[model samples]
Target: MDANREIQAPNSGCKHGGWVTLPFITGAVVGLTLAGVGWTANLIVYLIGEFNLNSIDAAQVFNVVNGGSFVFPIVGAIIADSFLGCFSVISIFSCISLLGTVCVALTATLSSLRPTACNGGSGSSCNHDHPSSVQFLVLYGGITLASLGQGGTRFTLATMGANQFEKPQQQGVFFNWYFITQYAAYVVGATALVYIQDNLSWGLGFGICVAANFLGLVSFLSGNRFYLHDKPRGSPFMDIGRVIVAAFRKRNFPLSSMPDDYYNPITQAAPPKKAFRFLNRAALKVEGDIRSDGSIAKPWRLCTLQQVEDLKTLFRIFPLWSSSIFLGTTIAMQASLTVLQALNMDRRLGRHFKIPAGSILVIQILTSAIFLTLVDRFFSPAWQKVTKKSPSPLQRIGIGHGLNLLGMAVSALVESERLKTVHDQPEPTPIAPMSALWLVPQLSLVGIGESFHYPGQVALYYEEFPASLRSTSTATISLIIGIAFYLSTAIIDLLRRVTRWLPDSINNGRLDNVYWVLTVVAVLNFGYYLACAKHYKYQNVEKEAAYDTCD
Candidate 1:
């Protein structure tokens, strides 16, 4: 057999043959679309200045527009797991995202047409700002629609992509390539977006996004035939109930350990119910279960409360995971606020060169790729040989967070240097813009931390949950992340309020203080995560052969 055919044989449940090309194509297209969205969003801030808006108003507008993405993933996950299957969910959402892209482009076009449509009056309070309430009503509607699609796209596509490769050994390589490609998109998208926003109009920037999203949609739709469609199991509510009922019966049923009638359906005659007295045992409390005599029968005996509590043990570990939201938010800043920070940096690469700040994102992307490749190819195997035990994903999380904390510390040092440079150098041309090179160490550290943390965290959440609650579990992780964003903002706000005594030179528009705050937060988060890691007892799902996975 050829390599492709060999890989497909083991994954009997997944349809891998004719559909292999579909996933790779879709992944690339999706990458382009996401890059496009990011580029357009960043361009809006620059475009807003053309409307005569002041710094604060412009910042608020940008925050509101970007922050709109926070809660939309929940909606996407709900629809995907419940009503629409993953494929349909992706299609519908991708299409809606394209609509949002169009709206963004139109908003820029319309602002040029009638700035009055933003605000009612003048002096930066114009009625026709980028998508006013009427426009916002339209814009937000599109955003909401697109968010639903985009949020679930990663979760579903990654899973579907993995499904395309079936061989046990190939699965590892498949996921490795999958993550590598996704991050590759992040790098390409970030780089391309930086270039586009610097050179193009906001309308063109967003118009490009629209095209990219449409391409993603096309790639997904075309591969519909090759995907293995696993119908989602029924609602957890019913399944949970069934499990409880069965557990209770197993405990309380008077059937005892007596050999239950064993029939070989292929060879034996059907045994009469009367053959086994245990069938009438009173302990079997299965509701509505009936006997052949039209009499009330039960499923089995009742389970002890202690038995139920045994299953409930997983709930205890949740608080530890949930509390990490604070950490998630701080880490997320690498994507959100870090971009803003880069934008504010002295972008002049040297005396004669001016590079876009967003280009710094490439540093992050490349670092992640290099580290991930190293871990899979070198580090993981080396560790396995030395310890005679593979590193658990949870173990990796603790280590990842430590690196993340160190990365934050490096960022603080970089910021301090920048602050020192601005204070000491009075000249307009201060010796090659204070060496923008300092940011490399910090950005590279963050990239390494990302490689350690993100993929492992994703796998951790899914693997830790009972199969029935995978969606709910993953959603919980997302919720923590969303909550973290709010918490990070709150912490920064609180710190700003407390530091109000500082002079503008040290405080205003300078993120040096913010770096310190993040540094402190990361240290505390890392410590907390380590403590949780020590106590966490990973579930051994492989050992539980007969247990119902229905929540």
Candidate 2:
């Protein structure tokens, strides 16, 4: 809490926004992140341990669930932007998440939902018991509902929280805290909750998640009076589609330089930019374009100048957006493979204290949470003080690109060391003697990188995108992540088929080569990002130094 912050009244008015709403919004963020990561962090373990799934089947199910969770945010965002406002959408989805968690908890509690437990002795594989159709239904149905709930609320809350502040700088500051809070909650979920789920009881673990989800819903609604809501102005996607159709229909029309030659809602409205000049024709007014009331006679053939420019903005951003795909893919792959690495190494902390393979990833989340605070408190100020300006969003993203690529390089080196240790070990020694803590540096580097790029990407997309797509803008990251999940699977499969880099026994395979390959790809992607960013122009005054102003 800021010392001088004023408490706003409970009246829901247009002036109700700014720091007054921070508590409620942040509370909701904590709840959602905690709840979402709880089940997700240990999903594969739950499937294999309880449902008697094979490693391959469990991994496949995890991918589907994870991918759905990331991809469904677009659906939530579209509904929020087009019909229900962010508040309604988030509230609705949070309940859906709670419901999903409840269903999962039921599965954990009820005996009928699970298959027979494995009874195989040491050094022998148990014949996996196949679950019945009804069991599968309950499990998958709950997963679907939960994914929908978590996905819809995740980034939509981000957009809503940012909307509380009018200043672009304040929004950026909110984003920083938003991610910090999220990463912190991720640590709790991945470590504490996962331990509870694995050691204590799955029912209790999921029940706690359900409670968290419900708490998030209540916390969000607590600020309803303080929220400055964006009224749904109909489907933004339709507007985007209309712009494309209109532009193509008028593609052959010559763009007129005169301002009056276009259709602007305001009488003296400025003309759209000439960047995508061909798109400007969508706003060009022909004799039959506008009716007596100034509405378009042909909805598909005519669009607002704003709509035309909005489409152009997406077109301009596409290249920079594409560069992030590989980054996301690398992140997904590393997250999955690191757990495997941990499983193969000495994960003991002290006598009788073995680290869970699933929880090893929390190191990354913990590092990100810690450094995000540093970036917010010390680093940004120091940078501003030394350079006479704060780092821009693009500068932050570029730094992240380098740091993340370096992390990949480090992963390769560490894997090489681990492989050498594997070779040095006496015959039949399964687990490598190398401490799993060696994996921490690579993960931490990526975590630190995320502290820069993740928030930077959020702020960049939110500020640069048109007002109509604010919610969708945040979800674009989700969409990118969704795509990357599939790409990661595809890449790993390709490696398995064509090369020995990712054989069944990673200790026998050239695992370091996989990291090196990712590193090379990331470096090339970084170069592409640089090229795009070098030529990219910030859309307006707000986009110019918005991130720096956050400091």
Candidate 3:
């Protein structure tokens, strides 16, 4: 038997789900990511250029928007797994995204919706047209709705794609492919769409985003007849609550040694493992715990062995998940800082071409996209050949941690160089003479690190999670990113209030110190992750050796 065939494929006799579903899934992911990233990629630029916000203010708004986009997925995932299912959730949100992009486009087209354009210069001399409170409300409304749409579809789409495969190895490979498509879309959006928004018209660029969103929805809906719709098993959160309540109620019941003392499935009647023995009380089969028909009689007094085990699994995984939050926080901070760095640095490629400040992040996106294929194709196979076993998810995450630390160090060195050049000047210059290409090395390393850890975390969560909570499993990543981004905002705000590291004018601020701080944070977080990975145990017994995986 194939070891990686972990889950029994549901409703196998039905004709849906297989390689045939790949094209539609791929199309949906590509179109949605393309449109979603188009606007998102140039957001700081838009808020600064179109909305007349200063650099620090724009970064703050960007973090909040980014955080919300990621945070909403948990709710969307719960609703899907509980009632609507992935198809419905994706469909509804795609339209919402389309509506949002259209509204944002309106802000670009209708001059009345925006503040009057500022004369191009700094300070009171430029006489900037500050957005009225009413104008800010209209603009924020569009961005908020778009973020909600983004939050709804992003991780849920990954869950839906993974569901199309039967083997655990295949599911792992699908996640890799999905991210490649996603990053490719990001590259295009950052480069081409940003060029349009910066060079041509914001309205036209946003119009293109709306069109792409619509097309993505169309492709996703076109595949409905071919999809294997997984029915919801009700809210898993309610079951989680039940487990806690039942265990507390039976806190005083003395544990029994007999095989029949606990609830078990008919064929799988083996006794529960001894880990977290306190939770085992929930599954204890007391005299009145079961009804005459064998159903659970007291909802809050008794739970199945599986429910107890599921809660225990979460308890074990939470520490590792918590470690990842700071990792994300550092990365989010870097993303914002990189844009600010590029804005101040020399962005020229040659005599004829100049790089867009916002589009510079595409280097990071492209590196991730290119290396995903390489890591999936060559790296894992080589590791398996040398070690006589495939690399596990924790091992991959450890490598990512090391690379992230190195990237932060490089970023600090680069910023120190850029600042030295600025200080050498007798007076403050609008832009540094140092080429923006200096930023690429750090971005690429961070990108490579993402190629390793992001997919590893996804596969690890999905493989280790209880079957009843699969959709929510992937959504957990969104939750981490969401919290990290919001925390980053708070950190930045605090820095501004107390220190001079992130001044409104980044050129005057100690940008290098910020990178140094993130490096220290990454170092401490990496140590924490190593401790967690060292003690953690793998839950999934399924291990298919046939396919090459990102791990």
TM-score of each: 0.73, 0.87, 0.90
Give lDDT tens digits, candidate 3, residues 143-255: 98888998899988887888777777887788778877887788888888988988889999988988888888889988776777666656787889999999999999988
lDDT, candidate 1, equals 0.55
Better of 2 and 3 by TM-score: 3
Write one digit per residue (lDDT tens) for candidate 1, span 1-551: 01211122324554544347556445544554463455434543443334434333343443443343444556655565556655676677666676766766666566643244323212244423443457546555555555545565655565455555556466556656666666656665555665665666656655666777777777777766666543444333343444355544454444433322221222333332332233223323344554566343442333222222323544545656764675676665544445444544576755866666556657777887889778878887887788666666666666677777777777777766766666665663222245556677777887787777766776676666555565455555666666665565555556557765222222234566667777787888777776776666556755223222211
> How does each model score on lDDT?
0.55, 0.82, 0.83
- What lDDT tens digits, residue by residue, belong to model 2 across residues 274-330? 787888988989878889987889998998888888899999988888888898888
Worst 10 residues of 1 by lDDT: 1-10
lDDT sort, best first: 3, 2, 1
Top lDDT prediction, candidate number: 3
The local distance difference test score of model 2 is: 0.82
Model 2 misplacement above 4 A: 1-27, 52-57, 118-128, 162-177, 218-230, 252-254, 267-273, 503-505, 541-551
* Stretches of candidate 1 exceeding 4 Å from the true structure: 1-37, 40-71, 113-142, 165-171, 235-313, 350-353, 425-432, 470-479, 496-498, 501-510, 541-551
Backbone Cα, N, C clashes tallied per candidate = 21, 0, 1
Backbone clashes (count) for model 2:
0
